[model samples]
Target: VDVMHAAFPNKVPYEIVYDRVVPSMPEKYKPLSRREFLARVMTTLLVPEEKWCLGETKLFLKAGSSLELEDLIALPDEEYGEALFKHLDLAEKKMAAAKSIILAMQAFVYRARFLRVRRGARTIQRIWKAIKLRRVWRAAAERLLEERRGRLAPKRE
Candidate 1:
């Protein structure tokens, strides 16, 4: 309810959404009211229907629900944000090295007048060159976190 209120501040109810909003949706979509959307999201998207209940004035999750943010943050796992950054950095370096090799091979193929081979090499080269660039933002975030953690650690003689 809080999320819904924040998203739609004017307070568009289920009834209004059913009568007016649903009908105006694009043809490819099956229109569902705000109530239906909430029901589906809570039950199907977030968790099973048994995990949550629709009360008279609000929707509440059952006790011991994993849907709670605290529970989500409590789970022990690898720092995936850092892992992903490392993975992407390695990927970019590999891609750059591969591009250099492919370009050299492409020139060799062109000199030999291998039309089909050159065409394929050009396609591969273009794909690697056109790949999206990323700055490994997670590395910086992790470095900041480590600095903060170091400050909080106990110092020994």
Candidate 2:
């Protein structure tokens, strides 16, 4: 078969790359965007809707996940691209915010470890303060991560 030929020139049909997916589907299955995510997990672990007072319910249907520009061709076009653009903007904001929190956390942990090694009280206070900020951001990020993971994970059929 073509797959076997592609995977290994001399391989049998059964030896082809078995787990291969169509190049397009994986990105479509990306977890929810962080704003939608944070909104979802902020109060209850449930995904949000306008009924929940988070915001308009239309957003659920309108929001973007993690698709690349090439993938958006199949996505529904906004009447004028506004809704889709807004959703994408929100996703980008969330990704940037999440990255910032991660960087802050790395800085905090490395600094704390350095201060501990230095063994100075002033350094300890500053490190602990940084650590506290890190913990808060990390907790927020963890909740988002857990929700995304839960959504993306396979479930019993």
User: What lDDT is obtained when candidate 1 is compared to the true structure?
Assistant: 0.50
lDDT of 1 by residue, 1-157 (tens): 6544333222223342123324334342245444554464344333666565544444555555533323322433333223323433465577799999999999987877887778899999887665522235566778989888889987656
- Each candidate: RMSD: 32.0, 32.0
* TM-score of model number 2: 0.29
Pairs in steric clash, model 1: none
**What are the runs in model 1 whose C-alpha is more than 4 Å off?**
1-30, 66-157
TM values, all candidates: 0.23, 0.29
The true-versus-predicted C-alpha distance at residue 23 of model 2, in Å, is 25
> CA lDDT, every prediction?
0.50, 0.45
**Candidate 2 local lDDT, 40-137, one digit each (tens):** 33222222342222222211211222122214334444321343344545666787999999999999999999988877878888999999999999
